[model samples]
Target: MRIAVAGSTGLVGSQVVAVAKAAGHSVVGLAREDGVDLTSPVGLDERLAGVEALVDVTQSPTIDIEAVKFFETVAANLGDAATSAGVSRTVLLSIIGVDRVPQYDYYVAKVAQERTHRVHSPGLHVLRAAQFLDFPGMAIRWGRDGDTTTVDDLLSQPVAVGEIARVLVELATGERDDDVIELAGPRQERIVDLARRLVAHSGEHLTVIARDVPEPMRNGALLPGSGAIIAGPTFDEWLSRQPA
Candidate 1:
């Protein structure tokens, strides 16, 4: 199989590239670092030539409306280029429950991406993944204010990035029976707790604070459904492998 991974250098995409190659598949990395601009890609069709599947793990740094424009443009470009190049499958990695959080700009942007891809991309498969296990580190960076870090008090079943990547490759190469599939970790946990543990494990002096979010988030909207696939090491298991 010949596969192209958009955002191929990212946390999940990189793993996908590695896993696919290890499984004896040809892989192309579609990323700015790899000389492919997703927002306004030039010669993208050439890059995707002979590619059997294209898995999009792209992300926007912004949490505002700008993210909406970024995803929409990239999806349209990828969809068109893949069609022209005769790519068989196009997979999009999305967040679980993005539709339930309209008030949040990032979630809104994700929903828009899903909608755009459905319209433009042929053989589109939506893979709604749970929060990553290391997301607490991101929360610490995003919410940091001197010595204090604020995080959401919401619950989540955060999967490992490697697990997500493996599943993405599986979905890309296997038969496409479902339009949408959700993936999550093995157990539910509080985001705030994970943040505090990460801070403590890292020996950081910052105090972790919990903040209440919107109702949907607080009421388990971010959690994967019963039909979702669950696989990954627990936080404690993964944390033990990390350097203190």
Candidate 2:
């Protein structure tokens, strides 16, 4: 099967490419680093020529209106390009609770992306996964304040990025299901605690301050629903595997 993966260089995208290749599938990795601008759709139509499936894992670092617009645009453009190219299925990596709660610009953008996928391509599979274990590390880096402060009080059920990629590969090759599947880690932990643990494991002594953030920014909408599927290695297990 020929699969096109957007954001193929990202934390999740790289894993998707690896798993798909390991499964003996041909993959077209699309990312800005690779000269494929998903936000523009310039070469997408041609690039998706023989693609049987498309897994979109594109993301932006900014959590603002521009990010939302970028996702919406990319989804719309990619959905249109895939549909026109006669792609059988397009799988989108989304987050849980995007629709139930309207907090945070990123969630709002994700909802828009989902809507675009549905409208532009009925043969779409939306997979919503919880935060990945590496997310805490990302937060630590992003929220670092000269080694003084970091974001805390947030909650997360972070799965391994590899596990999420495996699930995506499975979904891409299986029967087309125009449905949304929710995936999460085995356990939920406070973001602050997780960050602290990661820091301690790294031989760093950084204090994480747990502050009350807005419900939206706290990813209140990202919490998995009752029927959501939980999978993969637990946070503790993943943490233990990290290099000291």
Candidate 3:
């Protein structure tokens, strides 16, 4: 089987490449560094030619409205081109509970991506994955004071990036679909707690402050719903494996 992985240079996408190759599939890497501009879709048709499946794990550069446009455009261009090229299936890696959290900038765009792609490719398989175990580390970017970090507490079931990649490959080679599959970690934990642990583990002296965030973050909006598939490695287990 031949599979094309979008955002192939990313953390999750790179794992998909490795996993697919190990599983004996011919992998096509799509990335800006590889001369594939997903935003513009130049030479994209030629790239999709003879490709059996396309797994999109593309992410935006910014966390604002640009993310929405990025997903929308990529969804339209990729789905249309892939269909024209006779690509059998389209697989997407999305946020698990994005729809319930409209106040978020990125989550809004993800929902749009899902809707836009299905119109062009009816065989799109949407995998709504949970947060990555390393997500807490991202809190540092929210803005860090001299010796304190404001990490909002949110209910999250974080999965390992490798586990997400494994599931992505299984969806790509197996079948076509209009279904949404939810992927989550072994258990749930507080985002602030994870952030504090990461800071201590990394030997940071910053004092972690749990600040009140928007209602969207405080509620269980980002957590997986009922019937969600639980993937491997609890947060503690995953963190333990990472280098200190």
On TM-score, the leading prediction is 1
Q: Which residues of candidate 1, in runs, are more than 4 Å off?
A: none
* TM-score, candidate number 1: 0.97
lDDT values for all models:
0.91, 0.82, 0.86
Evaluated against the true structure, the overall lDDT of model 2 is 0.82
Separately for all candidates shown, the number of backbone clashes (residues 3 or more apart, or on different chains) is 0, 0, 0
Off by over 4 Å in 3: 175-178
RMSD of each: 1.1, 1.9, 1.7
Per-model TM values vs. the true structure: 0.97, 0.93, 0.94
Q: What local lDDT does model 2 show for residue 215?
A: 73
The digit string of per-residue lDDT tens for model 3 on 1-244 reads 9999999999899999999999999999999878898888677879989999999999888778678888889888898889888998899999977888787788888888888888876378989988888788888657488988888778888899988998899899884243788889988788899999988888978888897766866777778878777887898887788788
Question: What is the alpha-carbon RMSD of candidate 3 to the true structure?
Answer: 1.7
TM-score, prediction 2: 0.93
lDDT of 1 by residue, 81-146 (tens): 999999989899999999998988899999999998988787898889989998988988999999
> Which runs of model 2 end up more than 4 angstroms from their true locations?
175-178, 216-221
